[model samples]
Target: MSYCGHPGLMPIEQALNAILTEVQPVTKIIEVALIHCLGKVVAQDIVSFVDVPPADNSAMDGYCLAIADLEKTVDGVLPVSQRIPAGAVPEPLTSGTAARIFTGAEIPEGADVVVMQENCSEHDGKVLLPPVLALRDNIRDQGQDILKGSVVVSKGQRLRPQELGLLASVGVGSVPVYKPLKVALLSTGDELIEPGEPARPSTIFNSNRYTLRGLLQALHFEIVDLGVVADTFEATEKALIKASNADCIISSGGVSVGEEDHVKVAIEKLGRLNLWKLAIKPGKPFAFGDVKGTPFLALPGNPVAAFATFLLLCRPYLLTKQGVGNITTPTFTLPANFSRKKAGMRQEYLRANAEVVDGKMMVNTYPNQSSGVLSSTCWGNGLVVAPIGQTIEHGQEVIFMSYSDLLY
Candidate 1:
């Protein structure tokens, strides 16, 4: 994956690699109950202390009998010596006799196989055995599912519902996980107004705040929202100082070269702007830097730009910082239902919908690809990555990234 665009602009892949290389995972680890471990990355490998199904057990509600005993029975009949239900221990199988065993019941010592109850009929004092039986049939061997001391879940793996169940299966009540990353969110623009406020001639409601907030929340990060800062160098500097207390800082707007864009200058005055600008459509003004010793990410003011840049760059960096091992968003190669006759210089991520048409999956891009059109994002389920200097034709194969893959 190489991208060709403006000489000074960084490629999206290079930008992501740089950000990941610079960020380090937090060292703090806390023990959390299994019920609360969802979306939390494990601090260490989770090893099983015991094997699942600690003992050989019956896999069916049937009769347990030693093969030799079954062979010795006359007229395929054996006396029932004992009954074993799930969780009940059984004595050694009486010779020439069978034990009535329920599913999950531990196999009695010296029992060689179990026959499903459907195969035999119960009488007044004996069970009629099947004419033939296979050794160990309908029996679950001990340790078949999981072995003792094996790693059930590796370090840095995020826990989902199934993971919680796995930990519980191994008798783990609590898990050690890295502390959630704390991020200070700042929206810088005087023209920005909070939602629910009266509309003004020149002010627009700040959608970036809610957009970034929702993204952060989806990743399970702690957010310190500083709200919208007045578009001034002083206000930006003050916010940066206050934001330094967090593990990382993410600010939207005030990153471009415009005179009112004071975040770039403020960051440089406090720390340093390591990287600026990216060769990506709708998000060329993205910036990466440090503010008062804390890592900072500056996004373009456009709501769509901020949303795309965060998923492409900031999300991975934040996940790395949170100790997650696999932060890559999955992409699929699908045929396009639309076409682009001309290619732009920068790589473009078009908001697109992917659906199955006549048994084939195809990508349908929204007609409008404007950075300021936030509605386009909601209208599409994923993104179609249009490479720099490349024109997409109808039915051409292209990389499609689903929002379901990126949101988390």
Candidate 2:
């Protein structure tokens, strides 16, 4: 295949959507306790088996009394029949009778309303009641929270803490969910040394692994670390073969148009490489293709470029491969706090911090923005996306994409 010939890079969103639209979900069904399914994406919708609050219950520590039994004690107190605490089913109520009940306790038969203890006075078996006694007050209606046979959550939705509780409440012990995507990560560069290892004067400590690993973990992808490989055909080729078994392969460095960059060559020898020079800052040399049918994503050598490409490109493709729905990214618009006049036809994502200034959300760019400077990425809460060829002035609105997204 032709490696290059003025292949214009698509916009970031268009590029991402193209990749994800072609992939499908990779998951199977598993029986697990609801407690373990939190933070997992649902493969199928959960239907409620039973109504929440199976029976009407007390929602407060109060007295359960028939509305007819309510009396304005002309001179003295009214009689109390019995007491019904939580978990106890009291005998049927008689005329002009009242039962005491606690929160979460099943309401006794023939009782329709519960008056808070503080709202009524009790002396001996006889009770002095308030003039007004309302029906269904402080009573939890059956199925109020959920209904039987109803879909609690749709398929492809991520389960959260509250979702787990809801599923457990409905007695769902197991759920169908998509399995995490399995990925193999490799870093290529002869001048790269692993963190904590002694490096020569010309070498820099490896950081791509940590950056890639963190993003993978956030996406809940199962990762296989291939470690660092020197820029040689033989060394890089071996790693590529090892990663061939993965659902996808990702590597940073060596994909650029440099003589020492051997990732592209290894990709060509192993399978294919579709290198695209993106018209964007910090992330330009991005290569995406395949290795023996397994998808491959080759990121630039700079740390920031690797991170940006992963977010702007690989993440969507990976999510597509995982069969995720609602794959569009979340974008928010806020006023620009600073002015930027540079004009380009490609979208620019600058590291920025957002804060509420005078009750309005505003974003400001970080001081230093170099592809190798990963610290700016770590410090940024979001990215300020300046439109192509648009000169943004202070107080003008700009689109912002937040890094607070838990999912990659």
Best by TM-score: 1
Error of 1 at 194 (Å): 2.5
TM-score quality measure for candidate 1:
0.94
Residue 23 local lDDT, model 1: 91
Predicted candidate 2 versus true structure: per-residue lDDT over 173-273, tens digit per residue: 88888777789999998888888888789999888989999998888778999989878889998999899899999999887777878888878888876
Candidate 1 error regions (>4 Å): 1-5
lDDT of 1 by residue, 201-275 (tens): 999999999999999998888999999999889999999999999999999998899999999999999999977
lDDT of 2 at 27: 68
RMSD of 2: 2.8
* Residue 14, candidate 1: C-alpha displacement in angstroms: 1.4
- Clashes found in each candidate (C-alpha, N, C closer than 3 A): 0, 2
